[model samples]
Target: MANVENRGNGSYRLTVILGYDEKGTPIRERKTVKAKNMKEAKKLLTLFEAEILTGEYFKAEDKMTLNNFFPQWLEKHAKDTLSPDTLQNYISILQKRILPKYGHFKLEDIKTIHVVNFINDLKKNGQRLDGKDGKLSASSVLNCYKAFNNVLSCAYRWKLIKENPAIGAKPPNGKAKKSEVYSKEELSQLMQLLDDKPLFWKTLILLAISTGAREGEIAGLEWKHVDFEKGTIRIEQAITEIKGKGVQIKGTKTGKERTVSVPEKLLEMLKKMELTSRQDKWKVRDLWEWPDHFFIFGNEFGKPIRPDSIGQWWRRFTKKNDFKHIRFHDLRHTSATLLINEGVHAKVISERLGHADISTTMNIYGHVLEEADKTAASHFELFFKKMN
Candidate 1:
């Protein structure tokens, strides 16, 4: 039998008798449970009592604290499963934000209220780790919340915790800023400035805008993946920087290979690179035995260039040339937006962008589609003019 007593601070203390000790003295245990109301308190008390009766209750030694379990979770659950970038974020939150606050607390001790309070605190502080001085955006906080909630959800699914408290916690909703893209006029001006630029720079930017491929995908490209006859580039892998491992080639973002069509002009440009490549290959042949498959966007040393280096170059180029500024990723949006304006079918655009679903393409480029919708409606004006 168990007894529940109000702790007078919106909490209930559950008292239960386990058994008699060797001295015939009754063994007693008590847990202070936090709940929204008496009904929840009663339910928790009942559940705890049932677990004890069935010998399924976790002993003190068996119970894991948030700090202890996180490392185990990282090793067993996250290591091989999540992308290096994503796994790094999980580890960061566990060490910096989450573990610092809840490390000493057991998994079962954390409740919906605790999770909700943690989010509230994050919203209140809103600090960023990247050294940017601005307050953290709601969307950024929401991302952190998602990482924290995912761990709890995993524990719940593994039966380490009785319930996933995060499910009951409020999700952080934030205003989404539209992606900024270069206008067609701006894009044309930028192209003119690139006339004397290196072929790698020109080709990388052009491919990004034409194919809507990520920077990693562009940098990961090898000559073998590019088919001059087929006029297509197979995106099989991408090089990315992981936390501990530094830079390594990995699968595409979606973990699936996708083929993107190339314009004949772009294909011709690539074919011309082989002539320049052969001239450069002699310079490095004696120094190092480079990989047989050379990256299309390799450095002078016949090694793949890091995505960050390209971004840095873009920033410097835009500043020096006085060009309209946009992040490299915005080039992807430019491609999708231009396709929408040209009345390209959504499915075709989605496939070209290697989006898993048409909705993703539509959602990101919806503003352009809305304008196209108006253009579509205005087409009926010619028919109505005859009636007038």
Candidate 2:
């Protein structure tokens, strides 16, 4: 039941009885509306009651803000489900960007307009937090959008919100930067430079180029993962560093293991490296702290090498040699590009790279594939010309 009481000067208070509480007291919802007369007030009251019956009425008393709900969502929802790195990323985005803007807003009060405005604001004036001038990058804004959308999605799923406002909001279509890779000539030059370098640097750089494995994946490799007879390396794990948690070994990026064939030359190098490790083990038997673990790229103490150390070394190496500056991960891109140029099938390349699907391979290396396709067309054209 519902009623409207005239509260003077065209103002009316509409109240609806929304059933009983556990103590049998009637639960009521009240809204104040302004109308010209009693008849208009009655119509407003009817509409309010209809909204309640249809579940379209938003409860004003819920009072749960984003600030209040985020912790609950993190504890009951995101913590167990998301990866540690991913969870940390979400927390960072929320703390630094999303929460600061709309955290005080009641969860139910966040509408599509709020989300739209938030995204627009991010595009306009979202300054970098690193004391750098200029607005946030398109990708950074996109990340903020994703994190905000995910949180609201959870809220909607948990019935805290009637709908996810983010569903209706569109984020900026940020273009992914093209992957940089070294040319064949440049790779040859790099390989030559590696010859004068230490065995560890030589092996690590060659392994990255030959296998197209990530830095962490290479760091996570163990002697047991190598098969000398088969000339294959099992890529089962990766090292990820969590803030305040030090280094942690986790499964592959896609949570699936793969076996990759390596060059015979690389395998022979691995054999020599294995012999050196065995000798070192014998020399420092009592001093070996990680006696149980046998990382292929372990430090002098036999602990797995930090993945960051690989990048740091590459930077110094590139700077010293005055080589064409490119990121260390570009070696993986270089490997893929070299294979594509050799006319290897995309599926084989996809599998070797441990991508979840061939489409991902195509997406990342599409430009190389395009160039390969052009070269293939030219070859066919020349053959037809010779036939003529």
Candidate 3:
């Protein structure tokens, strides 16, 4: 039996007289309530009763700590549902940062103030969990907080803890700044560099820069996805590198598949590449030797090209050509920026990029639109000058 009463600290105290402890002595566990009033105390009592009914009321074991439950929750529940890449990230955070600090503590012992202390400790440790190199990214620190919060939420759900300590804890602030797009002169230089490269590589880079399709979407494509008659290409799948699991070909990033339009000149280029593929039988011999089906940018062995490989190629191309400070993903950024610069509407760009939301399109190219506005004003000024 359990009852809760006001303890005069503007908080309530919950007393539960259960049974004998490990040594057969009569046991009565007293827990101080953090709730501010009687109504919340009643709610806590009801929750405690539900725990009793379910036979899950743990008597504050020393071994059951944040470190114990965090890993277990991830391994038992989250592993299968989360993509392999996400699971790996969780594992890295747990092993590198979380376990080192809180591994020995008990779950019930960790309070809201303890959470604040832990975050402060992270900052004191030079913001580097590994104790080497520089501070963690703002995104990475927030992810750490979120991971801790999730485990606490699980604990509360299982009645292992009274409340989540991480609840209302401050996460890292500020947005990750977007990367800059290539200028007209830079784009011209890149195009000239592409002209010097092999036909297949050049076409792949050109299509990526032009359409802003993800490297995986571009690589996972097939000849059938291209509609020369309609001048469009369908995006249906993505290639991912799953840690401890190598690679996987999966559904589109946004789950739903969609089509994107291609320029007529690009269509002509793809047709030419197809003709070249047919002419050079040996070019596809290795891919054809395998049982793997159609792939747009398959390897020499005919398997679907990994997105990492595309990244590596981009890196090598950039490094060799002295085009540093740009990512392959920046090609997508370049595409959106170029279109916005040409006065295309945000909705049209959103559809072209297969983004699920118009807001996503606007977020990516908002800077470009500001420049577009400036360009429009400049044009208007020039027209007025001509009239004068």
| Residue 219 CA displacement from its true place in model 3, Å | 3.4
Residue-wise C-alpha lDDT for candidate 1, range 1-388, written one tens digit per residue: 6888888778999878888999998897778889888888999999889887865566677788888888778888888888877888778877888888988999999999998998888776436777766667888778778878888988877777878899999898865678888888988898899878988788888889899999888888888898888899998898897766666788888877888888987887888886687677777886533466578887666777788887899999999998888888888989998888889999999888878788987787777899998998888887788889
lDDT of each: 0.83, 0.89, 0.76
Model 2, span 42-124: residue lDDT tens = 99999999988877676666658999999998999888877767788899999988888899999988999988988888777
Which candidate order results from sorting by TM-score in descending order? 2, 1, 3
Displacement of residue 257 (Cα, Å) in model 1 is: 1.8
Alpha-carbon RMSD of each model: 5.8, 3.2, 6.5
Tell how far residue 340 is off in model 3, in angstroms. 1.2
| lDDT of model number 1 | 0.83
Candidate 3 lDDT, 1-388, residue by residue in tens = 7789898866887777668888988676666667878888988977876766566667654339766787678867677666555666777776777777776778877787867776666655377746587766767777777667766777777778767889867876536767777987899988888887877888898889878898878877877788888998888877777776666777776766888888787788899887765554466565473345566676555566778889898998888888855889888988888888889989988887888899987776777799899999999999999998
Worst lDDT 10-window in candidate 3 = 284-293
Tell me the spans in candidate 3 whose CA falls farther than 4 Å from its real position.
1-63, 121-132, 157-159, 275-292, 377-388
Error at 363, model 3, angstroms: 3.0
* Residue 316 displacement (Å), model 2: 1.0
Q: Is candidate 1 or candidate 3 better by lDDT?
A: 1
TM-score of each: 0.84, 0.86, 0.76
